[model samples]
Target chain A: MDRKELEAKIIELVAISYGKDEGEVTLETSFKNDLQGASVQMVALVSEIENELDAMIALQDASVCETVKDLVDAVEAEM
Target chain B: MNILDELFAKAKEDPQKVAFPEATNEKMMQAAYETGRDGYIVPVLVGDGPALKALAEERGYDPAVFTIVDVADEQYRDEVIAKYVALPDTRLKEKALARRMQDPLYYAMVMQKVGEADVTFAGIDNTTGDVLLAGQMIIGLKPGISTISSIGLCDIPGWNGSEGTLLAVGDSAVCTNPNAEQLASIAISACDTVHELLGWEPRCAMVCYSTLGSGAGELIDKVTEALKIANELRPDLAIDGEFQLDAAIVPAVAAKKVKRESKVAGRANVVIWPDLNVGNVAVKLIQQFGHADAYGPMLQGFNSIVCDCSRGAPVSEIKGNVVISAVRAAGQKK
Candidate 1:
């Protein structure tokens, strides 16, 4: 719904996708560099985020958002 | 039983568990279902769960009949990532693991590497280069084997020879212009595969434009040197060459052209071409003009069982290749 909530949800999805603890995922944690998410995983992660937030997030736009905070910002902008 | 029948019988005895990373394709799904149903293999489909289930349902096949490994799920993702991290020479760490986990092929390879599955089959959705790269990077290479090659199992209608008359063309889909050493490795790998698949001791001929020293060129020299290297490396194998195609396969021609005695002369089942250009052209010519039944371009020399099928391969060919891969896996365990 909001920036904090979206960021938390994004972080949670990342953590779940990677099987990492929620505490390990941070705002600056990059999906590729930090989470080691491949292209398909990134798509899955973005899809999960969009479904949870019930918003239309462009895959192209989401793909460019490298970090969790960037994804949160993208979601907030769309909202 | 025929060669394929025997292979299927052997595979069905203890069907090797096979993982398909690109199981969403309709042909691939059909092949997987048929092979599993026929007891040739136990198919493990790796991909998104809902998508795979939906595809199976659309195809009138029950998804519950298949062992589906959903890489997107947390449990399967974590397990595959952990197995990958533990692999020898794995570059995938925590960050990279996330992305690699999303790849069905990578997950299938990890399953093979960890002994969860006996073999992995893909390349319908990916290229041969991609499948081989995943195999080499994840499943790793066989011990002391530096090169991974491909062998096209050719079955010519009227060409009669030993061991069901199956001929193998090497480096058909893998190496480009291998040096002498690499050529020797390809020859050896081809011999090993022919032996495993056809249950016959392979008489390998390193084919060239020249028969022995009759012709002169850098290519001929490479083939001759490859023969010498192969002999030194594997003295027990019946390998000889730098022979013309006729001298390699036709006994009458061998008797005329080959002045010296050789085991593989005129009776060779395994023919190693000088380069990919020749190998590719030769196999295709045989398949098209000669109306030969060509089975593979099967990937060889990997430690684990990984096979590549042609893009848009039919269901029957896919099932046959799976049996071939399973037979190889069974032989390797022995």
Candidate 2:
């Protein structure tokens, strides 16, 4: 996936994880500091992303994500 | 100590702290009465208070010890009805508002919702869907859970001639067929549950028909994809798969036969089956032929405290499931 698509997926994932309305998330948003994703939610989101992209992304990797950009970049690197 | 033994000992030591004889069923009442008499948890019976009292008296038991919530013949129905109607989104309120329903399970859910009890166990005669629907409407899912699935605890004596072995199998009663993502999610949930329930750090095996990269098909693809996703989602979690059952759990068998050098080989306590058909049938075979003691199809991922009990569940199973639900709810409490 391209950067834009990856970023969009990250936003959609973050929104879904926190049960917030879509489009509320931005590329600059922090998953832990701003989005408040719990351990289970983080696990679920990574599961969704990996399925959508046909790749694996671990919970520990997702936990260190500070911004949507960082998440997109990390997922891109794995891809 | 074995978790089951510990639980039973706890049940024996402090009977008054637990709730029992939840409803007025003949068998449930009998078990609850006995459990209460043994000092497990306080027995709070829900139904017609006078009728319950009369029944207890007819059965030659003292009714004074059990607290009865008289909804049928008393104004407690309103109190019960109000509890369900207040649920964020449920038909129980509409049923009560229209005066078209009178069921104690809804009241039971409400009781659990309002903290009147620690847990509620039914399904003696109710279908799995019936119990699930009540829980979905009243207790709801825990925040962000997508679906609630069941797990079968399979134990095989001297597995491969060892002392004994335990396996947690899933989606036996809930999902019809799960996708790759669903499979991964179920495995993760099972891992969390096994860790908390059995005190076993989970080594998850995503099982397929073929071992390693030799298999090629949608089935194999699904398992591989699920394993990939599950691995990415919980990196610290000890999970690896796309292997046959032997490759997943038996290290000696895996090393000589399978190609991968997976850490999960032969030591996996959690087995994620391909689909519901495989999952359900495997668990049943293990329980029947393998003589494994199956504890639950305990529903997870829902908001409230709803659990599905087998149609042929004995009183002890009912009591055991109730304890499981109570512990689960207690963990979720704020």
Candidate 3:
């Protein structure tokens, strides 16, 4: 997937996991600070992303992905 | 059988009813379901009912199987507030009481206090301090007990210390820098845990760097004084110490270091550390390096049974903790 497509997908997963609107999640939206996503939810989000994209995202890498853009970049790197 | 198996059996026998305030988490809900299905507990999920139901369905569990109590309901909120206000020795202001009525932790405690539930198991999403505070404020302490303490039940393989490889380490996850009196209370609480949960005769050791006054310092003095207080509190229990860890556990070390012919010296299953620094570090070392399966830091000294789980705990660990709490509740009833 292209970078824009990957970023959109990441925002969608974060939005769904945190029960937020897709329009509310942006590239700079932090999983924890902005969305109030907990560690368990973050794990679930990563799993969902990996499953949807069929890409391997290491938990360590996912943990450091603070924002939606970071998560997209990590997913792009894995792809 | 291991300690978990023993507790599971006891839980099945009487099936203590339990409440979980933080039931929104999928892991906790799953464990609650499993424990309920296995006849270990009648699990009551205290939270927003619809949200919990949605989460349960999302996690592939049938919400009908669980008793989800909505704290936000008007009737439930009023009932909890009335119970909280009517509780003896409750010093919470009306504002605080109203706020607490909205908190699921306080609601769970209210359920336990009013015989609506047998025990409360929380701390999956909350901190240990939060759980303890809710427990202390709502449930109150046991009679004559002033301090709240914790005990970690360590199952060390090939180590025949207390009732096989099972041992209890106290004040590890609570009581930061307890005085002699608080330390004594911790020991007594740990002994009660061993007796209640494990069904074992507690042989307690007031562990320190010294082996019966072998070392000289304020720390050794603290352990010695705590041991005296513990003995005075429970004369029947086999309690002794101010011993080193080896002297407390290993018979050979006790023989060489401890001259007294005390029953607890060499065969202590419950070892009370001097402080949190020692107790927490020692338990973690045993868990990581010694490869011991540590079950708790199970909060003790409360009138009702309430346990706190690590935020990162897995479903299996939560299930084990629930069983342990159930055993405690069953014992308290007796």
Candidate 4:
């Protein structure tokens, strides 16, 4: 998938996982500050992204992700 | 004897001295009284002897029946504290042990740690956190247990899979989100718990939203990895999955969904949820909708039997939990 598609899928997954609006999720949206992505939500977001992207994103790599863009960047790096 | 009838019988057969530190509370007092009166346990109330006895009288319970361990007795207190501090693997020093012993909960646990009491039961007047903290600092965890978790017995009315209406589910009351290794430890602990407490040779299933290789995710990976780790750590156990609820318990569903020859899939007597979200919710659904009688959220992985009953639990529930604890402690004797 392209960069834009990857970002959109991640945004959708985050929105679904956190029960936020799709519009609320953005590239700049902070996972720790805004999303409060604790272990449960983080695992879920990474899991959904892995399913959508058809790629493996190690939780160790995903743990450092600060925002949606960071997650996308990690997935792209994996690809 | 599967639905705690066996434990109740075992407890009566070899009744243990169980300490109730929060005995001043009527529910705790009543549970202690009833469990003792019924011969499930010899309930020891740890607090001011006079106050407990007076409260027992006020509640129309016979005060003399309970062995009230007076924490204020400096002579007795010092002797017990010294013994506790001197035991192998004791975390606390003499001064710290003595100071913490002033608290009734600590006093009761110390009594157990030193072999005076078989089990320490509380949490009606205390929080789960309180009981757990005291248990960790005072009683300590079992040797192989890396994380402390809980196991509960669910006696579903109509669901008779392996153990005839009784199923064990765990980590619901503790561990918010356990990883693969912690999940493995929880599974192993659950196996030991059911075997020790209920006398069931446990068949454990690491539960998830998937069944075997049917789905994929980090969540599914966690459960599968947990089974791998558990198997590696203790090959004697029958732990399997990444099974969905039905595949874990229902034989027909297991035959359909899981093509592999899984020892645990079709007949899982114990179900270990991936995390607290699943464990906590599944248990409520089982109790409320399935109309199952859920016995515990009882803290396991302790060196001895240390129970933390929900504060909102009724007298009958408290009595049952105490008996469960007593029975578990009895298993330790063997």
Best by TM-score: 4
What is candidate 4's CAPRI-style docking category based on DockQ? incorrect
Candidate 4 regions exceeding 4 Å error are A1-79, B1-6
- C-alpha-based local distance difference test score of model 2: 0.67
| Candidate 3 residue pairs that clash | none
lDDT of 4 by residue, B45-130 (tens): 99998898888888998766799888889999988988886899665666656766789998999989999999999888887767
Question: Candidate 2's residue-wise lDDT over B4-48, tens digit each?
Answer: 665555555434223332355677777667666655556677666
TM-score of 1: 0.76
Instruction: Indicate the worst ten consecutive residues by lDDT in candidate 3 chain A.
Output: A37-46
Runs of candidate 1 with Cα error greater than 4 angstroms are A1-79, B87-94, B259-261
Candidate 1 residue lDDT tens string, B173-219 = 88887878788889888888877776678899999899978999898
- What DockQ, between 0 and 1, does each candidate earn? 0.03, 0.02, 0.01, 0.02
Ranking by DockQ: 1, 2, 4, 3
Ordered from best to worst TM-score, the candidate numbers read 4, 3, 1, 2
Q: Assess the local accuracy of residue B150 in candidate 1 as a C-alpha lDDT between 0 and 100.
A: 87
Model 2 residue B86 CA deviation in Å: 7.1
Choose 2 or 4, whichever is better by TM-score. 4
- Give the per-residue Cα lDDT of candidate 3 at B18: 92
TM-score, chain B only, every model? 0.91, 0.80, 0.92, 0.95
RMSD of each: 10.6, 12.9, 14.1, 13.2
Best candidate (score: DockQ)? 1
